[model samples]
Target: MSFVGKKYKLDKSENFDEYMKELGVGLVTRKMGNSLSPTVEVTLEGDTYTLTTTSTFKTSAISFKLGVEFDEETLDGRNVKSIITLDGNKLTQEQKGDKPTTIVREFTDNELITTLTIGNVKCVRVYKAV
Candidate 1:
């Protein structure tokens, strides 16, 4: 089955606070981000993919095509130029701004493993199918 059309709930996270700090997220937003468990839903329509991240604090959605650059407002409130690419069951997103970042989501074993990299700090967030 394709990795699309599945809903996943956040199970656990590692080093997320430190990663957020590296991204220059404010204390309040970082605290709320660390405490919130979000559900992510991915949907595919032709060449476009829609990703929705829902949490108690906020819900954000973005739709984009692979390899195409788009303007995106990140959860930490940074406006970035982003591009996403798909390799096998993994989706890698590169966000360009003052501090460039890469986010990779790998789908396997009914779980979604997300790795966030900013400078030398890295965070891993695991989500299980819900």
Candidate 2:
């Protein structure tokens, strides 16, 4: 279950606007974020895992190792410390900074679902393998 080389295309999104708003993303960025469907891919080099997100608007990437904390600049332009870990079929990440959030990516046979949560707001985005 290396997940390397697998590509998934965004198929559905729920409450994404609220999640972005919770992360302090401005209206224009949020709107741009909502308008496009991004393709996400996971790749590995040595012990480092890189998750890349690409859309017509912008492309973003984050590379990290399991259980190791790294400085991350989020798509919303926040500098946060993030660490990721794997549990069964899910890869979970906890980000700490001005607006803390948790992101979980669960893998299944046909789809990959990413859940982003902060406080009382939770957003789910589903990606189908492509």
Candidate 3:
């Protein structure tokens, strides 16, 4: 996969803290989340794809097969049933749990652009390849 082993650094974000509040994330957690500029990497081995996110606060990773549902513990501590699908250069994830959320990651040659939506709130985060 072209994206495998490629790294992306968070360059900017919009309305992320508001989106976190919609998810019922606590104040402290939301503040930390807002301050974090994480690095993300995706890797593949055989049939499994692993996406890892790293920040000064913590590191989180999830592994799954495309189109298959898996249990996920989100960065903000939500336990979710998640599935990821791909179309062209966009990877879309749907998470069902206490609240349903949709995350879409669109990869371009120089950036990974992510949009998060939940409860009418949408947050966009741009990560430049480095």
**lDDT values, one for every candidate:** 0.94, 0.92, 0.93
Over the stretch 8-64, how does candidate 2's per-residue lDDT look in tens digits?
999999999999988888999999999999999999889999999999988999999
Best by lDDT: 1
TM-scores of all candidate predictions against the true structure = 0.97, 0.96, 0.97
Worst 10-residue stretch by lDDT in candidate 2? 1-10
Question: Compared with the true structure, what per-residue lDDT tens digits does model 3 show for residues 1-130?
Answer: 5778899999999999999999999999998888999999989999898999999999999999999999999988889999999898888999999899999999988899999999899999999998
User: Which is better, 2 or 3, measured by lDDT?
Assistant: 3
Residue 47 lDDT in candidate 2: 92
How many pairs of residues collide in each model?
Answer: 0, 0, 0
Q: Spell out the clash pairs found in candidate 2.
A: none
What would the per-residue lDDT of candidate 1 be over residues 34-96, giving only the tens digit for each residue?
999999999988988999999988999999999999999998889999999999989999999
Q: How well does candidate 2 match the true structure in TM-score terms?
A: 0.96
Report the error of model 2 at residue 27, Å: 1.4
Q: How close is candidate 1 to the true structure, as a TM-score?
A: 0.97
